[model samples]
Target chain A: MTIKNFLYVNRKAPYGTIYALESLEVVLIGAAFDQDVSLAFLDDGVFQLTKGQNTDGIGVKNFSPTFRALGDYDVTKLYVEAESLAERGLTADDLQEVMYEDEDDDWAEKPSIKIISRAEMADVMAGADVVLSF
Target chain B: MKFGVVVSEGPYTHQAVDSAYLFVKAALDAGHEVPRVFFYHDGVNVSTRLSIPPQDERNIQQNWTALAKGHGIDLVVCIAAAQRRGLLDENEATRQGKDANNIAEGFRISGLGQLIEMGIQTDRLVTFGD
Candidate 1:
């Protein structure tokens, strides 16, 4: 197997820098190339998938809508770090939409995308053919 | 495997540089070739020779210099990003009439063309940013 896997890790707040935005763009491009793409939100990166992002208050354009488009790009695996979400006081409900939705917020959902610990993040990188972080 | 590293964080404040070094070492240990490392945005700080990290610590600027010398890696600093961040090489420093210089020894100052080239040549492009 060629293992054309791409793991895009996002690690910044939503608005301040172009990191999050550019990362999403790259994911779309990867999917267009027919690669197996997975997105991991870690650290402050979880903010990229956070719900109720109000960009109107900041006078900048909103980017939340673009995230919903990931599914359209065939980006199926969306992993969020449980520790990061706990630190930010965010539950799966606080997120808009994800690869596998967990209504009960248990350890498993649908295909079980793994709401992993920080230690497992390296595994995500280890399996990936390419790891692009923002 | 060939690799391209995207560094977008400043040297002293973030873990991007440290991660880049670790990734490069691991790749080499795994028997991979690093074709090019591209510094963009705030990453251009790696080229600033003025960095003085206290004698007690491993100066990051010097660390990168040593890494490049040891591995013969291609270290590229983005010119636009460098100019915006006040980093100057010998030519730019003279043209701008700066009194002193601080960009590290082993890295080459370049443009986004290097990034595109690396993208085309490398098997994987790993990025570290904040």
Candidate 2:
């Protein structure tokens, strides 16, 4: 089987609808297929990684923790748009530290999320074999 | 190249279905092979046989039906999404004891695995949505 580059574009916030959750479900399942997977957070999607998310009042499952587990699934390349963060008044410090262990460097822990410009992100998107947006 | 199209919005309310239809039409016109068009989320609404649009406007369901009939394109609507949105096929309607089945012709209800398979099988998996 060919190892295709699967780029999942997440542009929706968590909880307004089922897109974010369902998109996450697809990613989790896609990870099992062992594809070259990477996730991009753009527009309102940047909000999905914000820290201190509380779903108690909204009655929805807090899926923010699931983002952390994505690293374990080998989905460690998370690209967050710099413009999107600026528009939302968010910084890297405001987001969760999703990290993965580096297999090449004696298991050294490294951050999975990368803050990137929209142009650079576009290049990454254009490089993908299959782009799945949500 | 084989194209896998995913429509994630409903008919009329959003332009996703219309755009997807046009994209598929253009792909076929260009002599590209579209193996499957997967409908998920509110997109399953496109496969509902009960959608009766105004006479003047273009009928979204019929557009897809014609595409399927004309090109032999496989229209696969996500079963979970279809069930949640009340877009049941004959088998599902019978199993659930519903008197009516609203799944339009040329569309079959399948699992999300079909979408994943499309990702693996096709050269490009383009998605249209809100």
Among these predicted structures, which one has the highest DockQ?
2
Question: A1-134 in candidate 1: lDDT tens per residue?
Answer: 34367777887877888678656755665564666778888888888777788887779778877876665566668788999999999887787765444445673434423577888887887898667677
Model 1 docking category: incorrect
User: What TM-score, to 2 decimal places, does chain A of model 1 have?
Assistant: 0.82
For TM-score, the strongest prediction is 2
Off by over 4 Å in 2: B93-100
**Candidate 2 docking DockQ:** 0.58
Clashing pairs in 2: none
TM-score attained by model 1 = 0.58
Go through the candidates in order and give each one's DockQ: 0.16, 0.58
